[model samples]
Target: MRTFWGLMRAYWFSDRWREAWTLTIVIAVLTTLLSKAGVWLALMIGELTYSINFYHDAANTSPLRTTLTSGVLVIVLFVLKDAVIAGTRSLVSATLHRKWRGWLNSQFNEALLDGNHTHFHAQHGSADSGAAAPDNIDQRIQESIKGMTGGAIGLAMGLLGVATSLYFVGENLLQTSVEVKGLEFLGSYGSSVLALLAVATYVPINTWIAVRLGKAMERLNVRLQQAEGSYRSELTTFLRRSFHVAASRAEDVQKTMHNRLYGDIDRTWARLIVVTVGYNAFEAVHNFLGYRIIAYAPGLVSFIHNKLDLKGYVTGAEMINQLIGQCSWLIHVMPDIATLRANSQRVTELANAIENVQQPQEFYSQSGRSDFHYASQNPVFGLTIQKLELAHQGEDATPFLSAANLRFRRGEWTFLRGESGCGKTSLIKAINGLWPYGRGTIVFPDGVKSFYAAQEVKLPQVSLKQLVCLPGSEQDYGDAQVASALHKAGLGDFIEHMADESREGKIWDQMLSGGQKQKLVVARIVLQQPGLLFLDEATGALDPDGKIAFHQAIKDNCPDVTVISIMHEAVAPRSASGDEFYHSVVAIADGVATKKPLVPNLPRELTTILTQPRPVEDKWMRFSRRLKQK
Candidate 1:
């Protein structure tokens, strides 16, 4: 019950609460008045019949006027009661549906921003459970809220009607000596002698069944939801893996999933069927016994005129009105109570996860002064490691990189060279504060900002201008300035074509090649021009000539910014004579960056270049085939 009210409190204070509450009160009053009027009409009909017997063989003119008036009043009350009820339900449904949608959207956005989103995958496996959102959440918010709110309001009104009807019927019965069998207490002032026995026999039994059955149904719903999510995920995977599963022979996998899903559905439905049958049978027997107790008392009288009648029509009408109100209230509330239980469990799970404490040794400590920067004379950039460790599955730690502490200065270029899977990319991510499963303290100046590009950059389904803005606004740059930045990164062609494009930008990610995407990322760097820049193989896809040109552009545009890049084989290619065709290629082995000359006399080659084995590839493919004819 506490869980039920906690979940519903949000709606109680919403804008629609005042209007909804007003309508509920109005509907309750009308329902009670109508129930009373119905009992009066029934009593009038019985009296009119008795009057005809007393004055037979004449025109029945005296009671006709009262009968006609009671009939008209009954029709008017019934119509108004139904109309108000229907209108209140419609308004509540609309308000709850809209509120739930907004709440779910807000939760999704906060989860993404507050948590370490990229690193979360490394620790938490995947958030790809099929029961996540737009399905389970959709049902909870839409169907669940309606059931809960309506049920609460209906129950309160129903109980009020039942209590009032019981009072009036008991009071009127005490005025006569005619004894009611199931209500022997009606013979006294404070009636309870027989009414107490009937209520005590069934009230507890009914309440226990209602609560226990509702809990079981809630469990069944959760299992059914899990089955649906699993089935849908499997179907989607099958379609993506092969377009023609029938021809490619994936029948066995599909059949296996079908059998599993079918089994779950059968178990859930079977449990629900058993409970439903038991409850309805019990209710039917209970109602029958209650009516028999009342009717048999008059039949048992043995005197010549012993049968005592105190308007059986009035008693029956009142009982039926109270029964309908109680049943309606229970039926409306059953779904809400079940939904509130499930939602409460989910919220408690999330709260526990967020409140978990972190260990003291789990986080690295800061040792140096408050603002120890990378460019300071005795520069110790955060925490540097003598050796870094990583372990494979069930294996011991393997040393990835080992080196003495090295100094980094502001406005200096530092290049890391390594083969694929040699931990170069991981190092860059560690420095930029993304992947934290390593031994290092990448300390930054307290207030300085940095920009970095990983191997795979994600662009939300947004426009080109928005992608290049990078932690800032697109409106901050003029059209001419955006064009200039694109030109420097060798992506001017794409920008010119996409200038007047629609905002959707879905194909922009796929229509552009790897090199084109990297160029756009670099354009963002030129626009923001952060204090530090980190690149994880950012220019790996560009040709040898394009690589050299990109390096020159970065040096010219942002001379004061410190830049770091991971070096790979595609940096610059060389000619057969070992002279070189471009510059900036380097060879790194055993954790040292040794520069290798890839081109002849391309600025600073005499001082910065070192010797290394040349990377070989077919050279004749560089020229066009059409040139051979000329």
Candidate 2:
């Protein structure tokens, strides 16, 4: 109950509180009206039955006309009630649920993206699971929220109708005393609410039985939801990488995995089905007993015993049946209530994760960690690291990069070369303040922007301009400037697709080859040129000629940007004018990075282009492949 309330109560406190409260109150009022309508409906139904029975006789034809009139009246009123109910439900979904769910989703969106998207994942075994969104978060945001919200409304409205049922329908049943069999003691003393008491006891007793037997319903519901989410998540992953899977001929493997996952859902459903059938069987007996209690009442028994008016017996029995049905509402919706609880538990988990994201506590901390950085006297636009150490959180404190001091300056193309899985990216992450595992001082240039690119970029399903100026906006850049950047990144062939901003970009991410994708990222970099660039093999997909073009493109567009590249191979590149392409290399061996200088010149001019009449045909040919040479 607290979990349900925890999710529901937050909406009224949000910025949309006025609208939220207003819609809720409106719905409540409408629900009350619907309840009143239900009471009137039961009263009219009894009257309809009473009038038909009263006028019916073998000699007179008035019985047929009366039956026709009463049946038509009842059906018309029932239809109108149903129509109003439909409208009310639509209003509730459109206004109340939509706004509240949207508000809740926005809060989660903010929290999940809190740590610069470090808090967001697909329930994958990456980062801290405590901070990430729970399993099947999309469904939680869509289906679970709907289940909770709509279920709450249904329960509330149903209860209201039941309360009205007691007021109107129970009025007659309570006034009459029992005169049938052993139940005579019920009203022998005084006029008593035999119907109300019977309803209260009978419904709950059966409900208790149903609950005890079907206790596994909540657990089964939760298992089913998560299992379905797992299957959908895997299916999406398979589709995204279908080309590789097909090439590797792993279709059979994927099919087997999918079957196993689906089997889990089927098993959970099987358990749920048994519980449900048993519940309904118990409910059927409970409801039949309901009819017996009201039918045998003295009010109806006297009507028949005295040969009194048929209206009395007819109306009394009708109202009494309605009263019992209303009282037994809980048993009827028991399965829905169980599902609501399961969904509530999951939604609450998501809410807890979002809460943790907003105020993240430290995972790991060491003494004097913040005091590592100090001001440097280096006259360059780059970073300085002193005694830097690296390690993962929740692991042993033996640092990977132990007490290594290194400095990189502007006008220098430095390579961080290391063996595969040797913590090159970890050092880069430390420099950028992402990896808080190890300690050291990382001194940075003030008021300078930095950009970090990894081996893979997940291009969003968006337009061309949006993809290029991602994490930014298309309106932020000019058309000519974007076109120039595209041409510069060797994606001139893709320029024609940018004409329609509304066109989907999802296909491009899949259709583009690795080299083409790398070129697109270069286009992104050229669009938003940063002062310091960190490339963790961002150009791994590009060819040798493309790599040379990439360096030249960066030098041309981002003149002052300090490029720190982590490479596998060692290549001391020299220009036509005897200028070094890379100023130095930071070789990582024996768990420390030692700077190895390859250039004597402090700031070599990197403007040696094909326009300067380079004698080497290879250099000239590579430059010709670039847009500027064209």
Candidate 3:
């Protein structure tokens, strides 16, 4: 509840606050005026009928002018109030609906940004594959917000009006009954009975049913969301990989997605049927007795005793009419109010999941190499490798990376090597500040900017030029500059052909061969030009020839750039060219890293030179001293 309030307060205090409140007040005033006009009009007509009946029976006192005038006045008031109410509701609904939609969308986008959309996916699972489905969160928020907010606010106002009217109407009925007879009804005891019955009967049962329904809806929502995701995946494949899906005969995939959606809806409909039927039965039987039969009972008994005429009975019925109408509104509003409460609770939970939950302790930026730090303001220790950890289900230790410590200074490449499941990717993510599950520090130059290219790339709907430019960037690049970079990465031909075509959903990540995609990833590295580059399987997709060419391109293009690559191959070839090429190779195995010999296999000449130690003249051996200085 507190979480929901925090989210709601952000909007309630926004610039739209005055407008929303004003609309709310206008709608409330109009609804109240119409309801009172309806009751008064009914009473006025009853008075006119009683006056005519008296004139006919007594045959002396004529009240034709008074009766006609009162009847006309009541009708005019009714028409005017009803017209204003209609206009007010239409205007308020139009403005409020749009405002609600815009607010919800903005909130959702902000939540995504603040929460780190990438982090949420990494922790919860992919947006497509997570146990808690995010696919339909947007849809659910959109469809539910307007109805929930408007209905909830309206019901609240209606409830307030009902309470106020009940108090005053009970007082008026008591005074009228005292004037007409000795019977003492419509007093403290009567009002208490009615209020007690409302609370005891409607509140608890309706609340329980509403909560249960919300849980069912939430489950159904998850299934429907999964089905939608599956359908979208198939659709994307059909559009981009038409030949592949067709050749593979993926009709079964399409059919299965459709069947799942239908099945979910079918089950939901059955549950809804039961819920609606129960609600209808309760509303009908309760309103029939409370509003119609019981309300008129007092007036009917008075008429039989001759203590009240038809006029008095009609006037009493008018007061009863107000109470009955209000009660009917309450009955109709119960289920929706419950649903709104449930939805509000969900919104709170989502807000808490993103914002309030404490994260694992991370390494402070101060404890890193002063010269090699990446955008931190202070310095403490060089190679500040702090505690490394990962979060799993419910506080159990699932160590993606454990007490790992390895650091390299400027002017060297430290290759992290590990067998499968050694947390290579996890290590890179931790260094990049994407993995908060681990607690550790990776000290580097304070102002250095780092760019990472993961194994799987995300390609947005944009031109090849804009794709390299990065999303939301305004830095424009000319065709010549883009072409040059593409040519260096062996994609110049593809760019020229695709320049004029829309590349939206072109499957750049999936359609391109593994090598081509790797080249593109490297091309982005060149284009973005970060000082420190962390490549996780950045070269896995590249062939040997492509890998060598791309590596050389990076060395030639960005000599001052520091690169820490994860490699499985021997470091001898990379180091053999010069001391600058490979001075350091840190091998990470079984969740630990150590400076070790480069793996076996080098070109025969280089191998012979490295194998046969020549005094202390070896460049790599001499360079070890240089590393120790930093």
Candidate 4:
């Protein structure tokens, strides 16, 4: 309960608090007013029924006139009541859904992106470390947000309606007394007593059943979401890799996995439906029996009989009985309330997970030294790691990287080489402050801009121009500049085709090959020209010549940029006629990084090229040289 309220406070006090609060208050006030009006209308209709049945002929007013007037009023009241409810519900629900989703999505995304990326992924794999992180996070973000918003609105309105209904209806039933002259049991208090008795008997039973059903449903809902998410995730994977699957002739294997996942979903859904149907059916029968008990109570019947005998009508007792029968409606809505609670629990769980992910924790210390500190000085340009050891959270026994000390000078190219699983990428993560499970002081030159291009490229589904100028506006670079960079990265043909089609906005990933994607990443580096760039197998997809061209372009185009690349093999500067592109090589073995100079052996021609001074040419001079050669 505390956690639930905390989640509510977190949302309500978020950046959009004013708008959220205003909408909530307006919806609550409107719902309360409409509910009270509805109760009043119901009570008035009951009184009118009694009058028409028992006192119509005795009154001076004509029976037909009174009946017609009351009928019209009833119709108007019902129509107005329903209209108010529908309009308020639609307006409130739509507004809240949009606002709440936007806020929640932003918060979740910020937490995921801005926090420790390595820690986040580690938690997903290890339950002990990050037990609070939700599974199928994509589904949780999408579906849970919808459920939380809609369920919260419905639960609030339903409770308000129930409260108002009880207040008005219960008061009417309690005030109207009934007496039987010949009966010694339950005289004037019969209606009130029976109403209270029925409620007292049924509420606990209804609540117990509702709670049990709610728990079962919550468990099933979790499983159902997991199954659905798994199926969708697998489907996306298969579609993305359809060509590969076909070429490998593993269609049968993929199809079998798909069928098995879908079967799990189908079976889970069937069980959920069966349980839901059974619960509803049972509730219906339970409500009928509860209502019948009050309606046919001996006290109620005796009072009605005596009233009919004395006054030639039993309108008072009949009205009271009708009001008492309304108690069953509360019982009927118990399941909905339970479902709401379950949904709230799910939302609370997600909120907690997000909170856990975003909260800061003390950094893990491996060197047992706290003497290292970073000073905030001007013009930061390099990276320094001292005694840094990183391990996955809660896995101190097996360190990903251990006691590694390294320094990268400004404007120098360094290559990182290691066998598979030797923590080359993990070192990059540690340097970027995305891996928190390391004790070391990594001091970056103040105000240094760094960019990392991963092995598997993730191109957004946007225009080619947007993809190239990502994290920056396309307007920052003119089309001609973009075209020049693409050409440098060996995408001149792509630009020509795009120019013919007037490619204002188009997704290029589908049309591009693996080599092209790597080249595109290189194009991004060329365009952005950050102070420090980390490339993890960024050119692995490209052929040797293509790799050489990209490396030469980076060195030529952005001479001042520092490059740290992780690769399976060394990136030789042979393309530059052995003019030593990399200043040093850092090799990782058994969790330690040892720095070494470039390979000693080289061709005499390559060695001579390294000794020669190369002339630097501007872009225009290079262009003029190319024209002359042509």
Best by lDDT: 2
- How well is each residue in 1-630 modelled by candidate 3, as lDDT tens digits? 236556555655777788777766776676666566656666776777777677656653557776677778777766765676656765775676577657866776575565344325423432221223234444345554555566556665677667656666656665556222343464424433443344345445644654565455545444444455445554565676666667999878866866776666677657656766776676676667666765666566557767667886777776776666665565566666655655565455455444432232211112211111123422222233445554333333455446455555554555665666667677676666555343445666666666777776666655666766663252566666666677778887677644542434454554567677778776666665666777676777776667677777677666656667775554423433433354455555455555534424444344333432233356656555666895
- Please give the TM-score that candidate 3 achieves against the real structure: 0.70
- In candidate 3, the residue pairs with backbone N, CA or C atoms under 3 Å apart (3 or more residues apart, or in different chains) clash, namely 371-445, 372-444, 372-445, 373-444, 373-445, 373-446, 374-445, 375-446, 387-439
The residue ranges of model 1 lying beyond 4 angstroms of the native Cα positions read: 1-68, 104-108, 115-200, 230-336, 354-408, 413-426, 436-439, 475-516, 537-557, 564-630
- The TM-score that candidate 4 achieves is 0.82
Worst-scoring 10-residue span by lDDT in model 4: 362-371
RMSD of each: 8.8, 7.6, 8.4, 8.0
Best by TM-score: 2
Kindly list the per-residue Cα lDDT of model 4 for residues 314-373, writing each as its tens digit: 333333344444444444555555555555666566656555544333222321211234
Clashes of each: 1, 0, 9, 3
Candidate 2: tens digits of C-alpha lDDT, residues 1-630: 125686778778877789877877776666556655665566567667766556655665577676777788778767666777647755774677667667777776676666544353223222443444477787787788778776766677678778866775655554443344345565432223444555566677777876776457778888889998888889998998998999999999999999999999899889889888887888788778777764436354455555324554555665666666777787778788788778788788776655543322232232212223435444464677888887655445577675467878875678777667778888887777666556678788776677888888777667777778876889999878788889999988777777554334446676577888788888888989887788888878876677777777777788778878975444533444555567677777778677766645532222332112124576556655663654
Clashing pairs in 1: 382-443
Give the deviation of candidate 3 from the true structure as CA RMSD. Answer: 8.4
Using lDDT as the measure, what is the rank order of every candidate, best first? 2, 4, 3, 1
Off by over 4 Å in 2: 1-3, 56-68, 115-118, 121-133, 170-192, 291-310, 359-381, 393-397, 499-506, 572-579, 600-630
Residue 349 of model 1 has an lDDT of: 34
Worst 10 residues of 3 by lDDT: 362-371
